[model samples]
Target: MTPGRLLVTGAAGFIGFHLCRRLLAEGWTVRGIDNLNDYYDPALKRARLSQLEGHPAFTFQHLDIAQRDDLHRLFTGSRFDVVVNLAAQAGVRYSLEHPHSYADSNLLGFVNLLEGCRHQGVDHLLFASSSSVYGANSRLPYSEHDPVDHPVSLYAATKRAGELMAHSYAHLYDIPVTGLRFFTVYGPWGRPDMAYFSFTRKILAGESIPVFNHGQMQRDFTYIDDIVEAVVRLVDHPPQRQVDWPADPATSAAPFRIYNIGNHQPVALLDFIATLEECLGRKAQLELLPMQAGDVLATYAEVNDLAALVDFAPRTPLARGLAEFVRWYRQYYGTA
Candidate 1:
């Protein structure tokens, strides 16, 4: 079940980089695509790319998924066995400022990927969805069976849209598709916009860290390694025809499936900060702020289906994962 050539979009991104490295380690030829956009810091993305620069099995292309022609060219050229679409205009608040960016990348770009997979005869197509799609739902632990019709933010809406779009493609074209609902993914080489990374930077600089939602938020913070592990396992196992898919409106008939990949343990925001402080050996100056627009109060993922299907689950504790992240941060930035 080895992939001859794997195409990973957003290779320079946090998750994409890890997935590509893992694939290469497993003796697979990996082709990566990314625009190197200045979403946060292109330098960080470059640093991530530098880790895979010398790998003979890895090839990278600097192209945005929004560019349909360029993406079509790559698809036509590579004819990948597996396609993992991680490239997206990612941010809840940023979506409010630049809504068009989300439309271009998350919507148009995603359709282009589906088209490429459909035409190229890709075996398995995996794409990143978000826990944010569970918006405004007070459900204790969000499940694949739960209704995601009420998305609070534009970003969440787009992610939900991507899931539906993937389902449509899977049904019409018979492409095997899996949509992953990631819940508060964080670890080493993480996004700077994430609170854990920013808190470490501010704390080191003796600055105040903003605690959103007046520090009442909780999240199922999953580690990066665990995420990559789940993805790699799922790569070998594509969705099959659900012969007994319920007609109760909760299940679908397509060769498409969605799973929640998370730690399944929601940690309070204040407790997570405490873990960070312990990891970095510094106390953070906290400034409590009201919840911003397009923000959720909490996110808890129910990953039972993932565990049952893949026989593996994300188990990294926040304390351990943050310690690894702090170590990487200190070494990368020369802060310690």
Candidate 2:
């Protein structure tokens, strides 16, 4: 049940890089696309790309998903069996400064991906949706059954929009689509804008790190390996028409499904920071700050559906994941 040919958007990104590596290892011909924007350090993106440069099964394309011409050309040229769209303008707070970036990458870019899949006869379409879609909801464990119409940030709104867009495509074209709501994903080759990565950098530099929401936040911090494992399993198993899907608001007639992929255990921000300090053996100078706009107070996922479908679950603890990240960070950046 190997995917014949897989196209992964955002191939240079944190999660995308891991997914590409895993697919290549599983003996799949993988084509990756990325705009390689300067949202953060493009050098880190290049370093991740370097890992897959020489792989026989791997091919790289520099294209932005928002550009309809480039996207159409890529899809029409390559007959992709599975198209995983992970490329987007990815920061929550940054959406405030650059609202159009979100509209372009998350909104228009997603539409382009869907169009490509719809016209190109793509078999399975797996795209990155964020747990941030559970915004303004205080539920202990966020589930696919929960109503997520109240998104707090533009970023969350766009991701939720993506789920809807995927649904429309699935319903209209019978495209098998699976939307993954990733919860606090972190590990090696992670985004610098993420708190865990930034904290590691600042802690080692002996600089003051901002503890947002006065360090009262909690997150279901999922590790990268666990995430990639779930994604790979899903690549072979596309969504089917849920025959008994309830006539409720959440369930639809489309060949579409959404699943939460996260460590079920929610760890507090303070505890996460403590784990980072322990891993790095350095104390972080803390600067407690109010909650930033577009930031949720906490996120905890309910991945029971994912388990039932794939017999897989994210089980990496914060300590182990952060330790691995710290090790990579130190080695990558020459931080002692």
Candidate 2 ranges beyond 4 A from true positions:
248-250
* Clashes per candidate, residues 3 or more apart or on different chains: 0, 0
lDDT of 1 by residue, 61-95 (tens): 89999889998888777778888999999999999
lDDT for every model?
0.90, 0.90
Alpha-carbon deviation at 178 in model 1, angstroms:
0.2
**Residue-wise lDDT of candidate 2 within 29-58, one digit each (tens)?**
999999999999999999999999899999
Residue-level lDDT for 38 in candidate 1:
95
**By TM-score, how accurate is candidate 2?**
0.98
- Candidates' TM-scores? 0.98, 0.98
**Residue-level error in angstroms, candidate 1, position 62:** 0.3
Q: Least lDDT summed over 10 consecutive residues: which range in candidate 2?
A: 243-252
Deviating ranges (above 4 Å) for candidate 1: 248-251
Q: Which whole-number lDDT from 0 to 100 does residue 175 have in model 1?
A: 92
